[model samples]
Target chain A: MALFATCLTDTFYPDTARAVVRLLERLGCTVDFPLGQTCCGQMHFNTGYREQAKPLAQRYAGVFAGYHAVVVPSGSCAGMVREFHPGLVGASPATTMTYELTEFLVDVLGVTDVGAYFPHRVTYHPTCHSLRMLGVGDRPLTLLRAVRGLDLVELPFAETCCGFGGTFAVKNAETSTAMLADKMRCVLDTGAEVVTAGDNSCLMHIGGGLSRVRAGVRPVHLAEILASTEEEPWAAIR
Target chain B: MGSNPVTWLGTPPFPKAAHAALGDSQLRANLRKATGTIRAKRAEAVAELSDWERLRRAGEAIKDDVLSRLDTYLERLERAVTERGGVVHWARDAAEANDTVLRLTREAGADEVVKVKSMATQEIGLNEALAAGGVHAIETDLAELIVQLGHDRPSHILVPAIHRNRAEIRDIFRRQMPSAPPWLSDKPVALTEAARRHLRRKFLSAKVAISGANFAVADTGSIVVVESEGNGRMCLTLPRTLITVMGLEKIVPTWRDLEVFLQLLPRSSTAERMNPYTSVWTGVTPGDGPQRFHLVLLDNGRTNALADPVGRQALRCIRCSACLNVCPVYERTGGQAYGSVYPGPIGAILAPQLVGDMHDAQAASLPYASSLCGACYEVCPVRINIPEVLVHLRAQATAAKGSRGPEALGMAAAGWVFADPKRYEAAQRAGSLARFLARDGWITRLPFPGSRWTASRDVPAPPAESFRMWWRRTRG
Candidate 1:
């Protein structure tokens, strides 16, 4: 498997990439990174910029053309591809079905545990695109259930926006902060040690709320959770 | 941005103060007091009805059924209205619709036209259009009058000038329109009396009136206009000639559908089980009501919106503005930012669809205007699931243009690696090597789309140790 290690994992949270890779390898699969890959153009595409986003999409289409299946860890980025591909092509085409990770695990690969184990109190934040866009109902949760010693609690208003749209916070700061305050309250209400979600945008927002108040809550990516296994020496192999 | 007249709804001019009152604080207070009170009342009133959910379901189902056969429903509405001695005119777009209304007013031989608070009129810039046609359209509703005299736009649907406070309104009434009585104070009673006197003469003498409909029952050919002020009743019935420009989506299957709407609209809108005035008329009455009636069922890109299955449900919106009141965005920008007469949550989803699926930039900007908070969905009298529609529209809009950016590149790259286990594992090795990139476990300054993320909030630095590294060391 070639890695699309999303820009967030590659540039900021590479450890999530390492976990995702080891989790996959523990399940007996090879991972590869297409070094030429870059960021998904969803940011520019969403902010009412059409002309600025085309070449990045073209670069993506050209670089990953023949791959059997492409998997994205972040639902928002995957949404930009699986959902926005036709928009990228500017026309409906016969070809366009890339998979987000949960989609890959459940639909293509048909596996839950990547030989992972984790012992901790964890709560999952159903990222916007992952829940509504990808419709990954319980796939990540199904994987979470497989881990040994996992204590998972449900977050309240689990469907609400964490108020971290790419530019929404900066553009509408007060409203964004107001929404974030509500989301953090919910995350804290669950009394879980860490918050987990597939999309980084949401985690970043929730984390900010937790950090701003120096609240005892932290957010973890789904990839980081999946990479935890007691049997496999994952990090050394990576 | 404000002058384009093509701006998406809820695109206010002010930033809502990173913590300030407003470049338009008057607008904010007006909206806050109005929306807050309405939202609370709506909750209370809706709670009184155990069947509210069922009613919402019924409304959704009826709207869905009507929209699926929009052509048929519209044709039926047009035919029924025309057969009853009312003239039925088809407007292809706003310009045509404006032209038709102006021509009708001209033919009526009326110099000034009285108006009810109609979104359709504001939707097409009817007052502005009437002015161009050399017609002075007098807004009789106190709020509408405030907006008119103040040279501002209507912010909220139910309360057109909800963006103004009493003092601001008093200032407008005192200065903008000379006809306003000098002693008129901004007190509710004084303002209402002053407006009544100023508009009473216009209502009794005006030969023509222009309005919009809240619901147009196709089966009975009845049109309903709900308002707090009795001005709609006067504008609707007093004039000899009456013209109503109703959107294609405003029709219900039958008068029985009114049972759900009459209950839902007011309480959901003003948080009252019933508003003060509700004017329902089928056609001209022999001795009472307007003698000459014209119903203009305007399409103007609605059919285009109805073509998208996932998006078509947005048409189910009853314009109750329940979604708007509970909406955080609408709570801040106060309808001006939307740049459209429609603002808030409903505007975010509806404007993109109504303006032809974001072929233009303003429409494209509309979808990004929401937090997908789902509060809009929870408060939607019809259960529109606005956030779902927003995501769907965002997809259609992007698909319409075809995007090529770091976001797309990122999805495709991630998509390929996650496809194979070996490659995913190898990528994990690279991940450990790249952990240094995120400093102190957080990445503050970002680039491009990611920068769009860091612009408002701080990104938590990556953990000093990967979960994988920690797990491997502790267990293995």
Candidate 2:
């Protein structure tokens, strides 16, 4: 299987990509990182540049064509490749073979318990794309619950959007902030140490706000938590 | 009567208007409370049916059939209405519709007309037009009365005054309503009683009444208006001359088709099994209802929407406002910021298409108003894929701006970079230089376009080495 490290993860959140590699290897799967993959053109397609997105969609298909399976850690990126790619460049092997991390784990591998340990109070925020687009219901939570020591708490209004929305966070910054404020309040209300989600883009927005207010809460990726074990604990790099 | 001329004209683009609305804590609180309440109720109401999904499919299929052969259905409806002793008028746009209504009201020899709360009339700015022509159109619906009395634009579709709390409503009534008793309190029943007293005289005295149709049955030529308040029944029955301005898309093929919508609309909208009042009328009866009836069939940009294959689904909207209630953006910014009678996710897609002018900056901005959360799509009774239409309209808005715009240029540059792996890697390497700006591992400020992001949220500094660089170094 090949790893489709999305642009956002490849750049700012490289640890997440590395953790995916670690987790997959631990599960006895040989994960190949395709060097030619850059982006899935989600930012372009969603922000109204479909014409610009076409070439990138074609490029994504080209790079990941021969892989047995392509795993994307971000639900939105996987959703973009599967849902919009067909419309942009027609359906290709890349569109069909791609799976979000949780979907790949629970459905493809048939493994919910990855034999991981993360002893912390964690609340899972189901990102909009993951919840609605991919319909990845309870898969991530199912995985989180199986972790040796992780305490999974339910987030209030968990299905609601964290309002990152790629360019939407910047274009409609005020409304985006208002949405983020409610999200942060919900995260704070949960009294959990960390707020985790399947997508890094939403986490970035939520984390950015949590960091700004010095809320003392961490926004961690689901992959990073799953990658952690007793022998090799996942350290907070920052 | 007290509201200013209803016009979306001169309204700022969505971001600007939403910025102003976000500053109002009261509006935000009101919106959150009202929408939140309805959101839960709608869920419970919808859950009562086991075949809700199947019902949605049926509603979608029915509306799709209506939209596909709208001309035939409309002509059949016109014939049926005419046969039932109703005059039928076709309006190419808002001006024509407003003019026909004015002429019809004048011919009735009436200076005042009572109105059922109607989005079609609101869209055409009928009251303002009537007021200009020296006719008074009294809003009979409770929320409409509150909006009319307060001189306020409706911020919601089903609940126009959702932005106003009971206190604010009482204040508006006291300030603008002459019939409002001084002792009128902010209690819900008291407010309703005061409005009832105010509109009672108008219902009794007005010779003409105007309404917007929820559904127009092609086979029976019957118009349906579902409301919580019985005000719609009063407006439909009491007046001698009745004028109903209906959007061209509000047609159901047969009387049986209403069974699908009647089941879907009330549950999705007001969270009720059945609305309190559902007024359906054919044309006219001798002394039973209105002596004379006129049905103004309004095209008014609806055809522009119907032309687009993806956007035509917006026509399936029953004006339930379920999309508004579930929308995170609408819950925060309220409906006024949309600057259209249709607001929320539905408005974001519908307004831009209806306006059909992507060059209009305000209409162009509506497509970008949503976060593309897909919550609205999940809750829609007719299964309108609002997120799909929103993205499609965004493409139209971008294409209209041409290739020379800054955003377009940026997109082109990014596309060029992403199309080739080497260029993308080089760009990633260059992006790592931003690590110099990091404070405690986060970039708090950025320049130009990135500045928009950094204004409210902190961006993580690019890692010293990207994931590919690490992979090649360690594994290659």
Candidate 3:
């Protein structure tokens, strides 16, 4: 088993990568990090640079081909791998092998309770790609419900996009900001101290906004909360 | 149609228009309220149907079937219409459609015509064209009347004056509508009463009526106009001559096919259990309704759209406006920012393709206007893969521009680094040097092109070690 630490999770939020590894290993599965992994080329392909994305996508398929099962922490990248990669990489094993972390936990690993404890009122935002594109329905929630000492609260407009659409946040900054404002409002309404999601791209956008407003709410990746245990509690977000 | 001679407005690209629109707090508030209410209602209406996905698939299949063998159905439609005593006119473009309408209006010997709310007429700038040829086309729909009275372009497909509030409607009526009573109030009921009174005179006396149909049944040659108000009925019946400007893609092969559409449309659109009025007229019926009927079947850029395998799915649109209400982009910027009669998620895909010129800069900007949110696709009754088409169009727009661009160059360079493990690791190692830019572990600002990212939200700084680097050291 191998983990595809998506570009953002690898370079910026390696803590999420480590947490995923810890959680999977704790569930009695050996998780291997494929050294050749770099990116899924989602940014290039989505931004209309299809030609530029081809080699990277091919590289991804080549690197992960040997692994019978590939787990990804970010739902957006997992969706790109499982859904979009087939078209780019020509029906490779990676397409069928790839799994977003939550789906990997509940379906493949066949466990919802990972023996984790996070004593905080947390609201979960279903990232657009995870909700619509991947259709990993209630898997993340099922896991959250099983966590010891975790107070799971419902997010208003949970299905709406957080507007952290890779290049979209930059290309259309104002509209992105406007959408983020609505998402932030919903998060505030939940009265939850922590906001969690399957993708860090959404968390980064949301956490940045929360930090700016001096809002005390913390944005944690789903893996970190799941990795926390009574023996070794997860560290707070930087 | 591809081009609007009278109503083109030489509109600026999407970003510029959206920038201005974002500044208008009132417009934002109005748009937020309207789209929110409509989206909620649509969701509830759709949930009532246990077989919603089945109906959506049927709707898609029906439209796809029509598009695949369009000429056959269109010819059948023409034959059925002609046999029923309705004259059919074929329009290849906006100019042709306008010319046909103007000629028909002149032939009818009437300088004025009453109109039903129609996207086709709006697409062709029919009112401006008719006025240019010394004719007046009075808008009879309540929302259309508000837009006309305000001297404004429609900002929505279903509700043209959705950008304007009740107070603005009152102001427009007081200032522009000559028939408005002096003491007209801003209340919606009052506004509707005023419009009803104003348009009643036009409906009764006008010699001609012009409209766009929701569905044109090929089997019976019956045109359907589904509306909330009885204004569409008045427009279809009272006039001596009725001219319908229909898009070629509106055809449904059989009357039975209309069953799927009847179930899909009203639920997807006004979120009604059933529309208040549905006018189905086949042809001229002497003494019963208009004695003369002209059906102008329009093919403006539709063939061009159909030519692209990925893009032809856009033609499945029933003008339900469900996509608009769910789209975050349309919610923020409103319809005017799209710079075309079609706006929102569907507009982002349809306008560029309908314009059919990838080099057209204004149209090119439409594809990039969205954040590629799949809300539109989820809510669309016809299952038009809007984001898929948007990405497809973006590729075309990129191909036409031909790759000397900076974004293209940057992607190429990144692709190079990512294709090799050593190079990619080095790039990751190089990225960690950006710790200087990090303030409390987040980069708040950056240099040059990277500024686009940091302009709004803070970007994460590269961690101290790449995951590959950490993995190798720990596991080697």
Largest lDDT belongs to which candidate?
A: 2
Question: In model 3, which runs have C-alpha deviations exceeding 4 angstroms?
Answer: A236-238, B1-7
- Candidate 1 lDDT, B167-227, residue by residue in tens: 8888888897667777768798887777777888999899998889999988878899998
Count clashing residue pairs in model 1. 61
Supply the global lDDT for candidate 3: 0.89
Query: In model 3 chain A, where is the ten-residue run with the lowest total lDDT?
Result: A229-238
Give the C-alpha miss distance for residue A154 in model 1, angstroms: 15
Instruction: Please report the candidate that would top DockQ against the real structure.
Output: 2
TM for chain B in all models?
0.90, 0.98, 0.98
lDDT of 3 by residue, A65-114 (tens): 88879999988899888877778768798778999999999999899898
lDDT of 1 by residue, A1-238 (tens): 5556665656556566777666677667766566556666666566544444566566567666777766778888887776665666652221265677777777878887666666778999888777766678889899888878789999886876787776667655566776677678888898888899998778878886686566777777887778776765324434
Q: Ranking under TM-score, best-scoring first? A: 2, 3, 1
Error of 1 at B230 (Å): 1.2
Cα error of candidate 2 at position B148, Å: 0.8
lDDT of 2 by residue, B1-476 (tens): 11212238878999999988999989989998999999999999999999999999999999999999999999999999999999999998888988999999999999999999999999889998999899999999888888998888899999999999999999998888898888889999998888888889989999999999999999989999999889889989998999999999999999999999999999999999999999899988777999899999998789988999999999999999999999999999999999888889998988777777888888899999989999999999999999999999999999999999999999999988888878988999999999999988788899888888888888888988998999999886
Candidate 1 structure lDDT: 0.74
TM-score of candidate 1 versus the correct structure, residues matched by position: 0.72
**What TM-score does model 3 achieve against the real structure?**
0.98
